[model samples]
Target: MAERPVTDRGEVGGASAAHASRGDAARRLWARPAIAVAAIYIAARLVTTVFVAVGAAISNSRTGGAETIGSLLMRWDGQWYWVVGVEGYPSELPLDAAGNVTQNAWAFLPVYPAITRAVSFLFAGQYPIAAIAVAVVAGYGASLALYHLLRERIDRSAALWAVAFFAAGPLAALFQMGYAESLFLLWLHLALLVLVRRRFGWLYLLIPLMGYTRPGILAFALLLALYGICRWFRRRVDPLPAVQIVHIVLLGLLAAAVGFSWPLIAGVVTGDPSAYMETELSWRRGWTGDHGGFVPFEGFIQASAIWFRVWGMPEAWGYVALGILVVALIALLVFEPHVRRLGVEIRLWSAIYLIYLLLVFFPQSSIFRLLMPLSPLYGALALPRSRAWRIGVLAVGLLGQWWWIDQMLVQGTTFWQIP
Candidate 1:
């Protein structure tokens, strides 16, 4: 058109330069994997924070009590952790009128509370603040570790998507809670990362950390055993060295020892040979009504019957459903193409950990939280390249997060609502 003014041309040039600078900054931010993962983690945490705040607000309004976010974070099992941190495990177990062991600190491991106690000193000994801080920081570390772990087996885009799914999943609220799950997950993800990289030496340190942090080190031990067998079978192609063999054997033994050490420590301290086992069984009694001694693979079976009866179904149906679930899981691990792509080590770890849970864990409201360790499976779900599919799953996760927070944290007045 008309002749453009020189001043207008200069203004348009300046605007274009600014826009280009902003675009370059955006590209640079996404280029660093760590920074990008951190951004996703932080965004997820913010959404979880909103959920927690809403839960607390709703809880307080209903109860007419002072239910702040910190207090809500420290609810349920969080209180047990606080007890462990403040009072330490009792030398003599608490007993009911029937002389059965009641729920006590021995049911929880020491590392999480120990670290929380140390961190609390920085905040004038506020356990909730310390606990949440530890959980949030550990969760951030776990997200980074998970991304790196996935990157070992997948493309960068898939790895990042996996991390996003993990961070924003239904149990995302755990990442900011006063519970031990997030810290344990950080150790677990790091252990898995080293395992995938074939850096067996690092497991020397990680195994002990995992053993102390949670009750799943036995599963890691089993993973090492299976991994060793796999390596031996493939030695011709993979070139399994003698040093790696030693590392695998010793690590497996170390994990087993540490896995059983907690029970021994509890036994020695409380002067009861089955102190830890009894303490765990104490929780199961609430549902099963004073069960017998601990037996492998019994809890799930017992819980299934109890749950089925409660659901107005025949108890036999629970066994049938449980069998079907076991078969479906096995089929997925053995045949699912996406899961196979996650590599053998991940599959081994998942299988072993699920076995561990089926062996000891009583199915209850807490089962969802216990399943957090299997989160690497999110990689499989992230493998599909459809953006709409990914976004749909993410939306479901966010909705699930809200529902879990509302039921388990906000309207947690009933026994079944426990988180």
Candidate 2:
């Protein structure tokens, strides 16, 4: 018999393939570099949480609103999630036909305190403690997920830094309480990891559920479209066709349809979505007299402007800075070194999806957590050379994001109330 080359049946190729698939997970778990990144942040969060708890215990007092960063974590969105997890929804005061309510779960309950309640059910003693614990743990897992995903594409060290930023970054405050971002980030990491596998069919199925969770999913779905186009472009001659555009369209439609139904239900009952909006907007606007509720685009702009002023800006100047950052991001992506490597068709699709977010949707609801997906979107196109640079940039970003959210939740009063 002639000598023959070993095939996959010889075990090497099979094992290599298996190794490629599971390599990042194993390495990320055991690797010293990754553990070091995760550990520093883990210890930092542990110390901060203990400090906050001890401070609360020693003072025998608590401050609500934006006075202290810790208190901001304890209240606002934290209070809302705690309420839902502990009490569930009460039918006695169902949301109005416009989908507005005393506790408007429709506006933001897709990512509620379900995890907190489930964890609490385990011990049933200190729910507040349990809720906080869930937030901290979920935040940690989210860091691991982010690290693992980046590690799959980049180096192990790069992934470690990415995970470290996720864990102990200024945005750490979000996890210190029962906020949606705490849970939302964990789910997002899993979703994005699945996306990297080029599993559009699975993405289409899962994105709708995510869409139901937060308004931010609208932006996320759009980013997915951009990534899809990028993938399709990179392999045109030897094209990879497993992923398709139909999933993006279907996911968009599903998100739009499901989210729209909530408002439509109110329109059916109250004559317009603005009816529920009138109340919510009025409260948020701090109106002593009759003022209208959020009218979608108009309301978003108006309320966000007022909020910018509250953040110590003169008149929505933060929006201008935000615009500049976005512009820089677009310039970087459209002109990445791989632009030619990615076919024109793929590039075009990516542009369409990303531009749609900038032009139509994001400004309409440019909340921080709503824009969290942008971090990944930016990360996708950003080919960072220096690990130190990546760490430094993300450190600044995390701080700025924390300040923005802190101002929104802790400092500012309510704006446009739903009717």
Candidate 3:
């Protein structure tokens, strides 16, 4: 029947060859070094999972806490997100017996909870599983983006090692939990990538989503403003069109406006324009003594004094110690050659974020999570002159990750811990 049409085998062989070529292309893409970073990320995650599971199982025997892996992953902030996912934000802010507003869903942003709620619907209402899946998947995307960013400045091997360090960092366990750190980090890295590429228009879109995710949107806006100013100066020498200058100014203002919108929304919902800042200060009302005022950064100094005195140190010395630590960390972050390697925009972001943390946030055990944006320093750790040193740093980081999980989640301790 096919005498007129060549044998069907010939057509079949052509189709097979086409399929083979496509397969080869996929293989080539997978072989890329950045993809290897993702592979390393998966391996580190598996190791952490095994450790957390074992820790939980052992702890369950003694404490009868939620030893199941799923339960353990749903600790701390994850619980708040779950509440928001199942029950939307409360119509009224909760008040304590003393009449002060208590912890409410408004304290947490809606982005992570909204995503978890959507995923839970797809899973037939397995909210915990849905949240964990979102975090894990987002963590992978973040690792890949990190590798690409590092690769822009360092070699392939170093980039891989850097990603490994980031995945095994002290608070890396947060990535495995049903928390929004991974989601926030994914957006953070993506925004940085756009900024590094000088894609300002993308930020006009990204700042709004970031505003929904965290109140730290203003930090990024400040970073972009400073960067734009520098670029504007450079362009003055070379010169650009009046329209171009106007576009840049308008975009900068718009980004900052969008960045502050979330706080304004929170204020509106609570029936007080200053509700956002007032609510943040409410957490510090639990301090031990006449520690300090309600002003920004005062909580940090006050807490330092209380923490050291609890350990039997004199309060005055404790204040001195806190002063030294702040100065040293600021010096290190500002002067570190590694920080310098990140280029002007990223450096600006880091500097602004640090200042924002100092001025607005309090000192807490959860400071590690607050500092998660600095994970790029892991790339510097990957660049020691000796290979053994790099391996040592990564090994220590993984060990710290395991220790953090064991202490924070497995032990089920509630004595002023931030888990």
Output the number of the lDDT-best candidate.
1
What is the alpha-carbon lDDT of model 3 when measured against the actual structure? 0.76
lDDT of 3 at 269: 76
What candidate 3 gets wrong by more than 4 Å, as runs, is 1-30, 233-248, 288-294
Candidate 1 colliding pairs, count: 0
Candidate 2 TM-score versus the reference: 0.66
Worst 10 residues of 1 by lDDT: 1-10
How does candidate 1 score on lDDT?
Answer: 0.91
Candidate 2 deviant stretches above 4 angstroms: 1-29, 32-41, 50-72, 90-103, 224-235, 238-249, 261-283, 287-290, 293-296, 303-326, 336-370, 377-419
Tens digits of per-residue lDDT, candidate 1, 1-419, equal: 35567778889999999999999999999988889999999999999988889888888788898888887778899999999999998999999998989988998999999999999999999989999999999999999999999888888888888888899999999988889999999999999999999888888998898899888999999999999999999999999999999999999999999999999999999999999999999888888786589889889888887789889988777688788999999999999999999999899999988999999888888888899999999999999999998898888989999998998888877767788
* Model 2 clashes, total count: 25
Using TM-score, give the best candidate's number. Answer: 1
Candidate 2 lDDT over residue span 1-419, tens digit each: 23345553557877877988799777666666546655855775875555445444433443531244355455655676677677754333354455444435434453457767778877665566677788787777667766655655666555565565555554565667766675667766666766665555666655655655444555555565566566567766646554356665676566557655655555555555554344345344332232444344554455556567657886647778767876875675577653423233333434544554444331322344444543333334334567667767676755654454434543334442110
